[model samples]
Target: MVADAPLRLSDTNACVDAVIERVGKNITLGLPLGLGKPVRFVNALYQRAKDDPSINLHIVTALSLLAPRGSSSLEKRFMGPFAERLYGRIPELAYARDVSANRLPDNVKVSEFFFKAGSFLNNVDQQRNYVCTNYTHAVRDLMALGVNVIGQMIAPGDGSGQVSLSSNPDLSLDLLPLMREREAEGTPVAVIGELNENLPFMGQHAAIAETSFDVLLEHQPSDYPLFSAPQMAVSPADHLIGFYASTLLRDGGTLQVGIGSLGAALVHSTIMRHKQNDDWNAVFDRLRVADRFPVATEDGGTEPFREGLYGCSEMMVDGFYYLLDAGVLTRVVYDHAGLQTLINQGDISQQVSLDTLDVLRREKLIDSPMRARDVRWLTRFGIFRDTVEFKGGRLRVGEQSLDADLDNADSREAIRTLALGDRLTGGVVMHGGFYVGPESFYQALRDLSDEDRQRICMTSVNYINHLYDHAFGTQRLKAAQRVHSRFINSAMMYTLSGAAVSDGLDDGRVVSGVGGQYNFVAMAHELPDARSILTLRSTRQSGGEAVSNIVFSYGHCTIPRHLRDIVVTEYGIADLRGQPDEQVYLRLIRIADSRFQQDLLKQAQKAGKVAPDFTLPADWCNNTPDAVRQAVTRTGDEELFPAFPFGRDFTDEELTLGKALQTLKAATSTRRGKLVTLWQALREKDEDGRYAALLQRMGLENPRGLKARLDRRLVIHGLRKLDTPSDTGSKET
Candidate 1:
């Protein structure tokens, strides 16, 4: 029987009951990765599974957004208050709680295709159960593994009652038709949807028929907003990395960026190049971008963009809005191959007018004898309206008619001047798979006029992640539009051989899954002019000790050394594509942190990956974090490198406390540091009352116990450290 019109359930329990009735016991459930999970329904289902052992549950999903619960007293004291303030009213994830506590029942098996970065690093069960797959193939792989039930959160419908996939149309759109097919075959596939009014109702493929789902759940939308990824503070090192990556992007090129501090920094730099050219150019000169990377000048350009860029990303981040607002993302490429080619070659602008038609005709892109199909193609590009029709050998638009036989001189002139008319504008600045941004980003999308919304096409991940079209012919329109594509992704560690380890540890524990990084890397190599730019911080602090992220070799690789194209760090960029093993090693070491470079070079030399005769340059030796800060500050504009470029969720006071708490946590990571911090704190004076509210926020205003007093002292020490300027300067040691 055809799936009945969506049956609205009263509560989450009712929804669970309906799911049980539909799919029965021993069911395999599928959920969207993140943001699109129906929290209430998932919690109820998990509860039911706990009560009923016979109902074996295999939950296939990824990126469970769990609240941070500190492991120790000090950690708890700091994180508890911070989480409460930053994540107000956002419901705790029941599944994540079970996984974190190892309280999951034996009958229920939770397998994730992706982890919320570093969330499952310590969880043995999650690490062993992690599914290795790309983002574009997630749904397909899950279906092949027999996921009988699929559920997701959605935005409420408009007047016609058409609900939208909203925050996550990522894989839902791809899975819906498959579910429908299964339902038709009497296999009992259930598509569950819950309406959350807080989600912005997106257009395009995001909108779906009301009857598409087998069961629908709705309630008075929560007063709280959707879960937002708090904006990360951009450091000077992050700015340097962004500055290097920005220099590699050519004008009128395609860009694919992920969501993070690096993305925000990159957008800031791109905007500066467009709006504040003098300042941007001056910074480039200071960095010696043209001299250091001569390949950048050949592959990219140092000049400010005369023709702006077009965005094509799997995730439409908040920074895209900032880029759009600053007029840096104004390159609009159409879906048609001919039109895109003309735009790429600078033969035609996005503004389609009579003059552009004349140019197309002069270039022989348009035929003199325009056929009926040609008229239809022109109409699709907004060159002609629906009121215009080509009948016989004439163009009929309302009462006015013009001859289409351009072979006749007068007819050709009339067709160019009058037939096309002045109404000419059709192109998209970006083609995104799905979007999850801050409240401001959502508001911007919600407030857009229908016409404006059309310019930001929201499609499926399959198109953005892959070049070959599975649905259409092999020669897809998307493949043609993607020109000089730069796929910028981040990695946790990289080997000397250019191998990347983005998701898992060398010991087999997963930090995060291979989302779309591999897919982009593969695509970069496939496309002739495209390049994958992997951005990584040279070092990270672990347990109060600094560790180099660039290693001699790694046990497991996400993007193998063979696929490596461009690797960038705060110090510099390493163009590793097709380079010898020794050259790749030397280039990566050159861009590594100064403290770690000698050690890395020694390791590489010991392994015979680099020549022993090679020596580091004197100037390049100053690749310290302090050096990066000094270089960035030399511009003398504090506003140029604000922590959060777009916007931040935390208040000014919260940000201040957060930074202090972070410092305290860093200091307390080691016993010796903790003792030193306490001693320094006890010797200091707190007469200014600057940390009064901060102490109160951390429950350290009035110390009642020994631990509380120590914690208070730690905070005080951290604050004092922040107040004092570092004496390290640009020294390597």
Candidate 2:
């Protein structure tokens, strides 16, 4: 493979040329489809095609095709209610246009775009043209689209050399082996770009030599900014849902968390228990206790929960980082590491030393420095040991252990000192990057070495497929059973039970997008041990009138009847999963919003979906939203409300703009022209003067106003509010 290879790496353009030379005219690019590198590659491909028309560029993957015109709001699109408010008012505000321009690069066309079918991550129906079973299938489909050469543009190590396609491992799917298979056949010319130069990772089937890629381009790795946890107002209802879900979490159970307010709030709540409840802290302390007086049990005489909960799943997001920081999880082992080493590694068996813990404490990796109280509590727990080594002399359990001879008296004292050094510090987990929101958690995980990194079970990218297969397997773990739950959320679930869930008010088209609610419902029926938990917010207040989320029916049904599972509200849990039509309606009505229960029961009678004798349960009727609200409400201290529980760092002005934009969105939905005119006025305003004034206020020279008009919306909107200066900083009406 290394016959006449050059000694050093080639540049990006040189790599492209070499690949072209090896293969010939037509080329296909299997890109990591995100807004980041893919956009640049497609732009370059179009530019390249301007000169060399023979080189073909085809894309085969899912990309987030957003609504056009982006958000009129100042914040980023992915942020919660702000985005919902902005996008939801589409028809009235004319914001329903596709965000991603449908127009393709002049050289590359959508006709050549291949998509993945049955994709859990993206919308299947929207993905038109050629579709395949998976990412690998999509790649193969690209070859059929007249692609003779494959181009991979992943950033390499140190951001400056050729990176083997194998090295950039992802949970989704790997393309290297398939690429090699094509190479074994007649196909050749793999172009691999190595961008990063500092620390490069080496693992898995992630190895490719210089000969593997005809072109090895050197460029800087694209510095993708980390996604900070977004701020959100965790409503009383949402917090209750979180508390219920928290109960489902076992002490040692692994967690798979989705992104957004729910997951972020969950992380915050878990952290809160350490400060709020002594029992929670005690449980954590006992679990961290070491096995000094090892029980002679067959389970290796080791404390069972001592290893703590291992995070195993695809996303290595903030929550995983949180567990690591809290000392609830430690020890990561790579797949290839020998199993025997698991028993022998000192770091694997031991807790973090006091010195390490102190260092982290000083650095603010943890919330605070360890106090005498902490040491006493930790000592009372099993985590801290009382042995010593002679080398370091006197060592505390929270400090470091001595290496002095155990035979001598002095050595024994040193060993005892060292035993005291052993404190509860995180050990061994795979982690990287800067996490500011949940920094403590991130710091703990990253404190581990690469070998120990594997033990963490933090990445479950393969679980998507593994769980899919496991659903049919004999023994069911927690992960497999959850897949069946997806079916209840399916769009047409109720249709199977001879009922539909749509509102009759379809006077004109609404701005509602077809979300993934239906897909989950369908999957619920397909898998065992899985059911959908349909959540309705009870009553929604609009225009001074409170409307029930549970209507006689929705104008559009995200999920149908047969797919309903346990529907929960403040009223109570309504077990509807696997119930007959009459029972389902009766149970659903029992737990619906209090104000609409009577009306819903009458309508259910009209539709014959309910039993004629079904009556609203008296006990269930007693618990209303107001009652539930009062029960959980704190007398004072707005911070205790759990609104923005994970918390946000935005200025008050930004908050006002966010709320105003939300109001505009709602107004636009019911009334037209108002939002469009407001948006136009905002968009047309000269932002340069404002930016210059901002720079002057900061005592810095102003940079040219080169940022796009849309980019300035966030800052401008915030600044615009300061000019008004009311208590809430209300903008001019």
Best by lDDT: 1
Candidate 1: worst-modelled 10 consecutive residues by lDDT: 724-733
Expressed as tens digits, the lDDT of each residue in 1-733 for candidate 1 is 3454789885888888888888898778898877788887888899899999989998999887775768766568767866776576877768778988998999998999988888888888988888989998898898887888888888887669799887777788788788778777888877888888777777766888888888888886542467667777887888888988988898878899988888888888888877888888888899888888776777777667777788989988888878877777777767676677776676766565656766677877666577688688788787766567888777887777787765677876666666664544567887777676666787887787877676777677887788776752244466668888899999999999899999888788888889999999999998768889999989988997789999888898898888988999998899998898888998999899889898889998998887888888887799887788777889968777677777777766567666666776777689998787777877765678888987787777888987878778777776777666672232121
CA lDDT of every candidate: 0.80, 0.40
The TM-score values for the models, in the order shown, are: 0.93, 0.56
Cα lDDT for residue 623, candidate 2: 43
lDDT of 2 by residue, 1-733 (tens): 2224432343435555655666665666554332112232344444565566555655444332232223343334324443343334321111101113343434553331221112212322233443423322333455555444444433243333334232123311334445656667867646444333321233222323444454444444542222123455666655544433333233333344434445554455454443344433342233221221111121111223344444443234456566665665443322212211332333233444444334334444332323444334334422335332223333344445333223355644553444444543323243211112232333343455654443343212223223343212222332322321222111111222323342112432222222233433454455554444444345555652556655565444444555566554434445566578776776666656678778878888888887778777675575466554653453233444356664464444345555545544443454444556346436634345754544232222332354434434434443444454561322211
